[model samples]
Target: MTSTNKESNGSPSPSDSSKGLWRNLQFARMFIAYALATFGDWFDALAIQVMVAYRWGADPLIIALIPVCMAVPGILLGSVAGTLADRFHKVRIMLLCDVITVVLTIAILFAPNAIWLLPLLTLRAMMGVFHIPAQQALTRQVVSEEHLFQASSLNGFVAQCSKVAGPLLGAVILAVFSPQFCIVINACTRLISGLVLWPLRKLVQPKQWEGKGLTGQTRTETESVLTQWVRGWSFIRSRRIILTTMLFGCFGLLAILMIDYQFTTLFRAIKPGNESLLGWLASSVGAGAVVVILLLNRLPQIGYGWGLGGGFSFIGIGIAALGWVTPLTPEIWVIVWGLCIGIGNGLSMVTMNYLLQKETPPAFVGRVFGIQNSLSSIVLVVAPLVGGILIRSAGPSPAFQYIGMATFMIGIVGIVLQRVLWAEKKSPVAALQE
Candidate 1:
């Protein structure tokens, strides 16, 4: 195995330096399965919102609870999910989660009221908390180290594509059919994803645990779950690169998420009656992401630090530009701003995944990602409310400008700190000898 120091510094792994990502058949299959599952998830997401807000005529607070239901499970159970990913067979966990999700999604059609729908939605989201860590762990296993960035870029591309296509498809279906029909389609997608992944159970065998944790710490089979979970946090703290990357990434995410939910409100102020322009702006973001992913994939290698810092800076600038979107502003420029934000999203996501996978050992990767997810979920829960408050008190334009500038400064700090934070660390033996 390549040393963590080498990989963390963006050096190509010796294992698969020459192998192209497209040539890896296992990754191709996994990509297809992930695309299907992610696309299906968006369908369910849009359908559920429509069901709650329109079909059920739910109040604003009740509608707000929908996202809360989805996010809270990750906040509560992410560590446990990550631990399971480390201990169990990842393929099996993904398969089981898919099956359970399919059942729950189908059951959603029969939900008589908001009370029943909320719990079912929460359970389905809980399945995702387990599924994500397992899928991420599985990605580390299937892809060689050198191609991790390309693989992560491709995954982000699929997600962005789904974010655009899924809702458009759901909207079209809802126009002709019903949200329940869309839910049924989601169930089918999960079922097919399970079927596609089922073959991997035989082809990709699980490695036996060596009962070793990070940095030569013991992680015996007899250890308690809490102990292992605590160890995961310890491992992160001990690795400065991983800890810094995760913290800075989450900080950028906080800034972005704070403004994410306010875009529509901003649009409303800029143009009162044009609803379709919002959709076009969203599609522009997806288009921007797609462009960046394609560009990154063509590169032989990428510097994780540059990707992270540049991406956040681009995002901050894009958000700040929105402040200029007055009634006199051209709609095309607004879309261009959205595209800029998308570009930043693409850069950050690919590098973030690559950094985490490269720095974390397979044994701890699940826990690492699990904790990352939990932290993100916390931001997801809080950031939107803060964004709302800021918009209401400061107004959208001023709030956007201030928040955007703060975020831009964060990116600058990340760039300045990257050299110190990501410098290759001395090995234990070398340190002891010195």
Candidate 2:
């Protein structure tokens, strides 16, 4: 690793180094496992959606149910998953989920009836509900606190890479093979992911909490799932900044979902003869995310300031591009929207993950992230249905315009709040303490 330094207030600052990606062997294992798992996830999603659309002649409305099914589980089971992550050895939970998912995928391959499709998809989604929080919690356990930001950035980068490659590979596989075969391949990926994760069992040591004897037993027995679900909100009540960030995230998620629907519909409208355009557009978005991730790792200072601002700007521009859709040049508009939204999502996701890791204690990180995931899932569920209704009545252009306007308002609010916080830091009372 190389080294550098910063000086502040006549004090010598710590030197910077490469952060030595290989320092945490267990973290690397987890990253590889997650990347492989995501590849399978993305592949299954794209392949199944296309298969259903082609074989069953399903429209966008029906296909939208696929995402809805996946998100529904997160909304319902996220808190439970978080609680489990906190209580158990997270690696064990993750490995178990992986095995369950693989079995479910194999079952889907063997029983390939349209009637069985929804149930199989729902089961897969349920496995994901457990897998995500466990994986996140285990990552924290494996790496040092100082390396968390970079680890998160790298994880985001790998996941985006999977998104880019998975769909394209899936499309190819579908051209030559059946959807059942794709399901089998997805199972194979999960199996390999599980194998990779098996070696990290030692890293996730279980915590031993001191018991309060009968009082603890009584409280445990009396606690309900609803109480656990609301615990995240209670924790966030005092964290004004994080709460505001989550609110911004909700708008960002809404904008992203709107663009997703618009992209699919627009591609179908513009080049209905060539469905490959949808995959290409999705790949473009993934490419943009990859670019942002790389830049963030290479340029930390810029990532902390302008990179964050640029991300929100990209989101605003992306939403505006969606509103500009015209039949005359829809492809160009789709690409532009993909680029902007991709960059925006990449920047926002990495920064938010970093902030959460920095501010939250290890014991509560899982619950906090679970809440964030659930909130995003809820927004996603509502966005498509509402977007579909708007498109039906007002037309796609106006629907997109409405989404864009709302996103821009949220971004403005975030910027204003940031400035207020900055001003407070610069005030005389704050300065005197310094």
Candidate 3:
């Protein structure tokens, strides 16, 4: 691990050996490609929603079901996908998925109606189920353990940039063109990601059978895909800290992701019949994340506990204030609150991801991330429906307030958990795992 020093102001500074994380040529290529892909996805999503709203006049439930449909494949097949990432070359999996995305994204363009697009969207989600674990595992391979947090921050930075760039771009294109144009842009982005990543095939190192023989391995190696998936699950079950963190993080996100399902309605509450404003407001959240990612090196030295707990707290405070804001209030304040939520979201997500990569056995990193996806799938499935119902019954404001309160309370619990479950001293696996 490269040893880090402090800047004059006392913030953790990138080590000379690691200072070039963002400047690393290999990573820069991958990150840019990944960001382009993400930007396309977000833009496509917004374009689809706009299409649905205009073409079909989708109700709240219909709006909510989009994300739910997207989550279904991850719930059912995420573990299997994780196991596959471990079994195969991760870079190949990513390239293959990106290729698949090019084909699948085009299908959305051909959808004659909004109803036809749902299934195509679900197919794209299925590709994501495979792409995510591979992406996480590959990220672990590219950077050093000491620089993991920084690497994760860079990744989040790209993601946040997408969130900012995507919708705003979508809004502009949608104004001039149709949903088909957005879909074409998404398909082209995938092709671009593939072209960018194709040259990096030599960069991703292959897994070594460190202690295993070519032909002496057990029958389990030759077993069915189901058997391999069970192995992935068994690995996660043996890692209690990773498991616990996954559960807690998912539970916390369950409270927060409601925002995604209800965001369209909530944004509309601020200014009805306006779509471009929604893009700008959505960009505000990403703008917050972009700030954090850019200045990530200057953030104070903090333990995983403080990082995670603080993130939760920020998100809670932001959402609560977001709910409390009225139409009479200035819209800038709403953007401010949304930015808070995005910052918290980026911090906790990236920190926990760093912890997971640092602690997990290299062999099982793919599977663990897969199981993490499954847990998130569960939250995504339930939260959207519940959030949509809350918006329908109690209205978006109260829903945001109540749900944000729940997250705020969870943040408090996370703080306590940080003290009790995590160590006063460091341990490699989730801060306390042995």
Total clashing pairs for each candidate: 0, 0, 0
Model 2's alpha-carbon lDDT is 0.68
TM-score of each: 0.92, 0.82, 0.84
lDDT of 1 by residue, 124-156 (tens): 999999999998988877677668778888898
Q: Output the lDDT of residue 222, model 3.
A: 64
lDDT of 3 at 175: 91
CA lDDT, candidate 1, residue 386: 88
Q: Report the number of the highest-lDDT candidate.
A: 1
lDDT of 3: 0.74
Mark the regions of model 1 whose C-alpha exceeds 4 Å error after superposition: 1-19, 203-209, 425-434
lDDT for position 234 in model 2: 66
> What tens digits encode model 2's per-residue C-alpha lDDT throughout 273-315?
7677676667778988999888777643233323344466677
Residue range with the least summed lDDT across 10 consecutive positions in model 2: 4-13
Predicted structure with the largest TM-score when compared to the true one: 1
